[model samples]
Target: MEIVGSRRKNSSFSSADDAAVVSTIPLYRSAPELEVRLDDFELYAIHRLRVLKGISDGLSRGKKPNEMENLTKELWKVNMRNSEASEVANKDIISHYVLRLVYCREEELRKWFLSMETTLFRYRFQLETTDAQRALLKEFDLPYKAVSNAEYESVKEKLNQVVRSIGQPLSSADTIYYKVPFEQVPDLVATRRVFIFKGYAYVAMNQVVSLLMTQYRSHLSKALVLTNRKWTSMILEQEKDRLTPIVEALSTSYLGPDYSQPREYGEISLKDIDQVAKSSFPLCMRHLFEKLREDHHLKHGGRMQLGLFLKGVGLKLDDALAFWKAEFSRKVGAERFDKEYAYGIRHNYGKEGKRTDYTPYSCQKIISSTPGVGDHHGCPYRHFSEENLRAALDKMGVGNRAVQDVMDKVRNRHYQLACTLTFEAIHGASCDAGINHPNQYYNDSKNILESRVRATRMVDTLMYAEV
Candidate 1:
């Protein structure tokens, strides 16, 4: 299927009124015609998705807002920046529109895209200078009542108290407080971060992003609903045949490295499997490993999940057969294992049936999988019960404070962030390389452990040489 915005011959490109330009606020109000190439359509959408995912990952890593700002700046520089200023601006605007089309299909997809886009806008808004922010408000026609000097002085003490309690130390003379209706800034009101006087919220200059964000979210949410309706009802039959599949697939696309290639790392021995799992595996794989060991058999889903991950981590097919045979032999003898279970293991290695070499599941795939009773597959952060997840964290020796933080991420449905938190708690260091795929986590953890070992060996060699 062709992309949505491909230009036809003799058609006007972008109008002067709809020129591609990046502004302080990227409120995409109008759809502009573009001369986008077929290849550029998927490329632009992937790049923008990475930026949005970077924001989600930053928050998942427990980064403060200032830290998240730095993270996104670097991501933009790497992913969205172009040599020309206008080109960069075009990418930003065009990519945003492309993703809107991709994500406007379902309610869940729309909600996720809306939340990430709003957070992105809020981060950019927070970085603008005060004058720039005011200009943006004026440009967007967001009217706010600036408190008079006399009215500000009347409530100066109360404003100071509220702002101070919220850790914003702005003196009365220095700050420009806006008197927005309490309803407009309900988040601040509910959190008791702003001083309320008569039906108005006294929001400090730095806090105006909250009001703007609320408005932006409301507008974008309604726009997505309308877009979905139009997408289904108004598109021409020819356009639907060309555009539907490409747009739908963009939402669940995985842009990470391929895991189906031949193993570059050396083969892992069956004897070392337990040690390797403990040291390098993500919690999902580790949990599955333990279950397989305990029960001496795993259901089909668990076998596929853990089995593919093992293959990705350099477990050769021979060792894999031995490993599964040993476990299955405990319950149903080696004969039964070879008769019933051995074919599936060989199939995963591309030696039987259709012989299709399947890639390991990414975090998105695992998170979306629905595991029924007796299944040990899927992301533990997303699938495990809270009590079970907390116990798992405790077993891994994650301290109480970090456990609470992980739990908070889980409660907010930030499953990947919870996994990142658990990684930090165990390693006692930040997971600088965010976890997007199960094999990525495994590779990262193994590299870290290997580095520590090499460092320790170097220190030992120096001490022995001196002796």
Candidate 2:
């Protein structure tokens, strides 16, 4: 890769200074032949890296900076307190190497790997002090560099010229700038968000992370597509033993909020299902509940989605079985219900085949999954079109303003944020937190409503006492 910012001029600097500059930038040197085998701890490092990447991705995607920063600091402090100095120090470097090995053969894998790595880099960069930042720049051999006062002064005229040409106001003196290649920051150029002169884009410091991430994502996307065409699976399979685990780790690893605890609406009986669904269930689940009630039956996908949600909301196995049987028997009689639908309901509760304790589907799973014509399984925000979703929201008593806001979020591809907004609209309160799981949305809705009820009751009691 070509280094874009702060062009290294050998003629201007002394030999010693040049050597110092070169030494600061680490090279991606190959590991020794004998050091090929990875230990169990090394394997665990991949998992740790994944966790860190997940944290970083979440921070980038709408999380409050202060909250994420504190969380990141706490994570490092915990690691240091455990005396895992080696793991703490080597994780950034070693994880990349491990991912490189795993993602080298496929375009899809490379794109995912690069996206996560870039997010990790941004998170680490944000956390570092000025000196540590310099150390990281050296450690990673990053192409971009901060502009010095002298360099800034020299480039000021050209920067102002470009700013004027683009019809944007001159940047404030406090606005720190970096010189990056124009090609690498096409998004900035396209959006007219950066000052470009010659071949470089003089990007503000605040825009650096976004610019770099976009470049990384675009570069990796293309690289992966090209690699897919040229690289064969036979070559990839040669190192499959080592690569397979990393791939598996990436797929199976989840370090987000746990939805396993039965915290929302506790001990829901078969008869109380309708009441709970109406008052506390998220829009997605509410839609499913209404459809099931209306039809007295649901498709398999809907059953799975709604079944796990009911279990999550503290519905016992016996109640769940009774609930399903009662609903389905209305259409198919008790015999058919027991023979066909009963087995699936029991399986969902871990009573039948495989006996796996299937948890509720998360927001990510729901949004990403595409529901068929008859299925009411997936996220309504993602699966439904703008017009259809708005109509659905309208029927749920959502105002035009709230529906418009949700439409804006959906247009921008912020599906989860749209769901949060929907929750706010339905509950008539600010959620004040991220909604990652359907169960979380349900729990938060119940909690918010309960709090409001308590507050109102307290006011009424005070009024009675005064009277």
Candidate 3:
């Protein structure tokens, strides 16, 4: 394989700096051979997964370019620093190859991994200097050649015209264009970003980044498929005992905060539950809350879903009993509420039956659930019919435009993204962290509302002091 050590005079890394360049930016064309401890293997895979999840979440929340850049920088510092440390570089390579193995088992997982990893690669590529980019592309052995002075002299006007059409600055005398096959860059062609001449795309210096992205995506995608085919045979029987469990766990891992643990907060008051539900609950929880209020009872599924979410957001056992009792007693009476419903509520808090202290359901779990007739437990964005979803958005006071945007995501089967849009519309602000769990939505909404209340109180105090 052509590695980073081989450099031309124009390459970003000189002989002295090749080691640093090789360690920092990865093409992921080949798997790295390194000795990784079991602990480091698990930790590295989780760290990389966290970064990929961060990228996916940021995109779902409609983060702007600069905001995403900032997020990437922050995540990189914490999870993927581009340091000179050999361990850091080794971890980066091993972690990436490990995820390829983890996600390669399923077509859906492969597609998701490809999309997120490509976006990540593009982000890192764009951060590089032009010379570094050229060096990397050369190492990859891409066939695109730079347009010669004679060729540029003939087509400079046409290239300048295309540049002007796209509203980019005119190409300078020093600017270089690459003659790439038009078939390779359909994105630029379809978008009219590059000037097409005959059958070749005269990709501008800046536009070469897109070409690199396309090449890297194709390379990584094929690598993943090949990895999938080889996975089972590649692991020896002895190694399988050690590695198989880790692979299985990583494949199904939910790496978000542990909402199952008790949080530090005052117990939720029964009187404030209704207002809090309206202001802070995710649509799934909100639907369950409203249905329970209207009917004065919830079926087992709805109770489990909402009960655990309430517990996650800091509802104590006594308060949870009183809250459910007030609603259930309206129909079943206090006697029936204690006999049937109260024990189940206590079970969710680790007080009854097997006493498993259940955590709130994530968007993935909720989306995967099949809500039967008369059940309002599943994700609204996933389960609600188009008309029902639209009406729910209208009830939340979301504007028609935002509602349509939410519908678009739901149509694409992006249920969590749709929930994120609803959160943004209701709060009139972007959800920087995105909505993965009902409790996360509630906590984020509560914080936003509390901050607004504090701001309003400060304004009121200042006005009264002037009087």
Candidate 4:
């Protein structure tokens, strides 16, 4: 299948767009908070993605006599590993890395085997349903609005439009459409994020995308449902001598199959744009980037890292766009804006990919500070201790009683409100849930409290914005 947006290409590394790119954003580079130390979580996945071959392939190869014994042991270990990944007993920790595995490939067969590892997070899609467009489908046994289309093409075009409009202004009520595979019907599981529905299969947002799919599935029943799964029996056959599909571009700046646009930094290559040369940005942004790479070990190889980090730092998109230009030594405009900046904005604003858009602490971070040394960039609701997270909340202008209540809930693993209040303080919005949600991650440590120091900084932004 052809990748989306590969036809038209333009970049502004020489003229980076701040509204979209992280390298141009300020305070994003230095003394930043919320460094996602995905190393440990990342390290564990390398062996699985790189070394393991599908059981079918391993079977057909007929392991050399000497290697057969070890292969058997390894196969047994693979089964155990899959068990640990899927049905690890904790009902809450589903899909720990199923999509990550799927991210290595854009096919379905490899995913079929991976699906067997865990059932709790299992997910599937349907194109044509027997019921009305508004009928409800069972999701984790919860009522989620669903639609189906027997005709594929009608829906695929619709979904294509949705992804194409990346980085544009968004509304809560925009409608969408798409076409997907007929095989997806039995494939629906909780772990899958993006899927084909009718014509367009996706997993952008629960409510938003579902609405779009419902509206257009009836229109485009001729398109094919595309499932971006990592491994499949068919794909495994072609794996010999080919690079295993691993998502190279986890961010826009990195070298990935998704983003290969060359980027410029301060009149030089992005790889060459180091702290020594361009010191024009807010010290916080620059310092933060260096620290992440140096101290905390967060890699900013992707352009998204810096823009994403700055957004996390509370810089508005307008200010962010401007900061990047001044730091650059070249000129940029619409073409640059379309491909690079737009891609970053989509990731930053909760519009695309796993929605890493929440401003970390836009008042919602339950941390003492955003995130810094000694503190891993973990989910604040699940990371912080009750006592410390409470103190950080109090510092963020939360009331004394509210702090106490919030702290009590956080200690009890009530992450929604802890996440909500932090969100409310900064962004000033809310939802039905409050300090109450399941936490597959449980921690009790100073590390949680240490991260809250950045929470205090978020409160400062709320104070300024409200004033």
**What are the per-residue Cα lDDT tens digits for candidate 1 across 3-106?**
01112221121234434333466678777678887667778888999988778767766688789988877887799887787887778888888888888977
Using TM-score as the measure, the top candidate is: 1
In model 1, residue pairs whose N, Cα or C atoms come closer than 3 Å (at least 3 residues apart or on different chains), thus clashing, are none
TM-score of each: 0.74, 0.70, 0.70, 0.25
Q: Which stretches of candidate 4 lie over 4 Å from their true place?
A: 1-100, 103-306, 309-376, 412-416, 425-429, 433-467
Q: Residue 337: error of model 4 in Å?
A: 25
Clash counts per candidate, in order, are 0, 1, 0, 92
Q: Give candidate 3 regions above 4 Å deviation.
A: 1-23, 82-84, 144-154, 197-199, 229-241, 252-256, 262-278, 287-311, 314-388, 401-421, 427-436, 447-467
Q: Tell me the spans in candidate 2 whose CA falls farther than 4 Å from its real position.
A: 1-82, 93-116, 126-158, 161-183, 196-215, 218-257, 295-297, 329-336, 454-467
State in Å the error of residue 118, model 1: 1.2
Best by lDDT: 3
lDDT of 2 by residue, 199-288 (tens): 877776545655546655665555555544433545356646765555545543334555554764677777777877877788899999
What ranges in model 1 sit over 4 Å off?
A: 1-22, 106-108, 129-131, 139-153, 167-175, 228-249, 255-257, 262-264, 269-275, 291-307, 316-359, 364-376, 397-421, 424-436, 448-467
Clashes of 4: 92
Better of 2 and 3 by lDDT: 3
Better of 3 and 4 by lDDT: 3
Against the reference, the lDDT scores of all candidates come to 0.79, 0.66, 0.79, 0.34
Output the better candidate (1/4) by TM-score. Answer: 1
